[model samples]
Target: MKRTLTILSLTTSFALALGACNQESPKQQQEVSAPAQTVEKPESAEVVQDTIKKSIPSEATGRIGDASIKITYHSPGVRERVVWGGLVPYDQVWVTGAHKATTVEFDRDLIIAGKSVGPGKYALFTIPGRDEWTVILNKNWDQHLADEYDQKEDILRTKVKPYSLEHPQERLKYRVEDGGEAEAGIRISWEKIGIRLPVAGK
Candidate 1:
């Protein structure tokens, strides 16, 4: 009877030890699983956001003389509120386009309606007006700034009369048109504003 009791006691001790080991394995699994949950959530959100910005295609083109001027305006619509709402704000220099400074080139120095312009690329900028507008020619052709534009680099500043468009423009556009007798009009228009700069050959 003692021998049988001893065997029963040994079996009971082994079963208790097995039960304790099974309980500890689940506790170890919970500790390992908790750390994995913390790391994955924010990383997944960032990847989704970056995908959205890449989907927008922002580019446009036009010509400004014998010279072909490529214009890349803002992809998003240019509104008076966005352009005037302290972003492009009023009575200040605007680069006139989105990416690089808006570029205008002349094939050679020609008397643009008696005004002399040398052959080269110039940065085109503008100052909006309620009654009239100003088209500016600046020597510096690269770099972008809302506040960093220097008027000293400006080669010329000319007044233009802004006209109301019959139809709303979806994107800003520039083109050179035959102005008769070796002259052309460098027309810039968008939204409600349409202005032309007349250029003539020397």
Candidate 2:
């Protein structure tokens, strides 16, 4: 009777140990199958262009007697490109700048190329030619390029002769020079040519 009881106890313990191992086997398999989550990294941004546009802002200011005169424009570089008949076409209205219309302001009434102009701001435009260029002053000072330019809005139109520059100018430039008393000269230079327009108080 004692030997049989010991055998029964040993059999029960072995069965319980086997059952515990079987129950733990599934949890171990689940831990091994599922890996830890990881975060994904984003890609680096790229640069689109290597260089910026060439057009830049320019301003010229001077006094004609007691009247203040100012000109604001965009200066474009020659960059080995033909400017006269190629980039800036002839016989057409040009903005005289790159993105916006060129502006001319006067503190008092002034005479430009024999035409009377405003005491306020005005848009400056030009029609370029090989020998002579026509300069126009419009009442509409705020505009984009020459696309919105209208001939009916012109307040003053005058013709000026273009001269060849012995030294080449790489960029477009506008200058107002004080010529003695009430007289002032507006000079526009670009590429290999230049033009001068006389201005005086009316």
Candidate 3:
């Protein structure tokens, strides 16, 4: 009987030890799993953005006397490339801007370089030169990059001298400057060059 009792006690002690080990294993697993729940994920690739446009739509509008002048064009950056006499060849007609032909709109009758022009929208083209630049106004304002430009459709053509600017202009820009009274100046500036056209109420 003693031997049988000893065997029963041994069996109960072994079962109790095994039960303690099993309970400790679950606690260990919980501790390991709790740390995993608190771990943070990496966020290196979630905060990047893109911001660049090749050709941007730009506008210059101002009123001189009773005439309202508006110029719409696509402004392109210099981007460290050659401008005059290289990208823009001398004596060749250029759209004066990028993508589409630069357009000028007049709300009232005006005189451009002493030539009378009625109120209308016209495409502005230029033949860039080192000393002189030819500015042309065409009747066909709705065109793409001077691809459909025709000399026969030209309304007025005038020569203007290109001047150097003190500071460089990174992007092409056009501005309508009020020249007092019934006069305004149309200025195109890019790189280090400046071209101006004088206009007055007619």
**lDDT string, candidate 2, 1-202, tens digits:** 9999999999999999999999999999888765532122233345454133578898999988678988999998887788999999999999987889999998988778887666999999999998899998998889998888999999888899999988988778999988877557799999899998898766
Q: List the residue pairs that clash in candidate 3.
A: none
lDDT of each: 0.67, 0.86, 0.90
TM-score of 3: 0.73
Any idea what lDDT model 3 has?
0.90
Over 1-202, each residue of candidate 3 has an lDDT whose tens digit, in order, gives: 9999999999999999999999899899999898666664464336543234486899999976689999999998787789888878888999999999999998899888999899999999999988999999999999999899999999999999999999998889999988887447899999999999988876
* Comparison by lDDT, 2 against 3, better one: 3
Each prediction's Cα RMSD?
10.6, 13.8, 9.1
State the lDDT at 17 in candidate 1.
100
Segments of candidate 3 deviating more than 4 angstroms? 1-53
Candidate 2 lDDT trough over 10 residues, lowest sum: 36-45
TM-scores for every predicted model: 0.60, 0.72, 0.73
Comparing 1 with 3 on lDDT, the higher-scoring candidate is 3
Judging by lDDT against the true structure, name the best candidate. 3
Q: Which candidate's TM-score is highest? A: 3
lDDT of 1 by residue, 79-173 (tens): 43344335445677777766567777666565553578888877888887777777888888776734557889988888888898888664567
Give the C-alpha lDDT of model 2: 0.86
Candidate 2 Cα misplacement greater than 4 A, ranges? 1-53, 181-183
